[model samples]
Target: MSEVAFRLFAERGFDNTTVEQIAAAAGLSRTTFFRYFGTKEELVLGRVGEFGREIADALAARPAGERPWEALRRAFDVIAEPRPGETGAPMDIIRLLSDACALMTRQWEKTQGWQSMLVPEISRRLGGPGPATDMRAGALVAAAISCLDAATDAWTAGGGVVSLADLTDQAMGVLREPGDVPG
Candidate 1:
């Protein structure tokens, strides 16, 4: 259903596309579509929620002794390293989201949601929360997400001329800077 929505969103502008159209294209009833996705925005950005969980789970699964920054880098690496035949979803979604003001706003909201979910888990992994621990967790998560954002932005701007995984690795490498030491 999402892939169908993605293709429709790409072929027809996001604003021009409708739930009814997406439902029809996917051969699902509008009722079924509603059962799956509450809003068109949710349908479009659904993978983001899954990615958020993936990052959190990846972080949680890392060696307990790993530094917070290093764990985050590894967590992000999970998503940054694409599987086979997975080249186009992000580019298409980025293009679609870039053009739509609503989705862009929702994107920001979604990111904050992801960050909120990460903070406590990060704090836990760093030996539980204090003001300092919470602050570090928040900052690290923000920086990691920013690295991904910058990499994706660059990828989109360059028409995907460079590998996104490499870009992500480069961007994320900044976290290793000595100045990025967490509390």
Candidate 2:
């Protein structure tokens, strides 16, 4: 159903596409579509709601001794790129989402919604939860997510030629000084 909707969204603008059209194209009744997705947006952003849990799990799975920033980067790897052995995503979805301002905004909004899911794990890595630790963990998670968004923006603009993980690394690296000198 999502695949059919995505194709329709690609062919027609997201604003122009309707749930009825998606249902018809998918060969499913409107009731069936509603049963699966409450709104047209869900067809696109469904996976995003759980992104925090996914990211947290990925971060937690990293080596225990890994630095927080490195673990964050490694964690984003799962979200940053297509899974191994899968064909690369068709540019149509990227184009579809990029062209829609409402969708772009909503997508980022959804990303923000997941930040809390990552904080506890991040706090754990920062040596357990407390005001100071949680404060720092929250900041780091926000920064990491922002960097990931920037990398994704660049990827969409560049036609996704560069690997997203590399782009994310590049994005995150911009915040750091090249040499280890006394600040």
lDDT leader? 1
lDDT of 1 by residue, 12-126 (tens): 8889999999999999899999998899998778876777888888888989888887787788765566566553355566777777888887887776778876787778766
Task: Give one digit per residue, the lDDT tens place, for model 2 in 24-106.
Answer: 99899999999999999877776566555678788889998877777888998767757654221423444566888877787
Provide C-alpha RMSD values for all models, in order. Answer: 2.8, 3.5
Residue 105 in model 1: shift from native, Å?
1.2
Clashing pairs in 2: none
Candidate 2's C-alpha lDDT? 0.76
C-alpha TM-scores of all predictions: 0.82, 0.82
Poorest stretch of ten by lDDT in candidate 1 = 82-91
| Candidate 2 deviation (Cα RMSD) | 3.5
Q: Model 1: how far is 121 from its true place, Å? A: 3.0
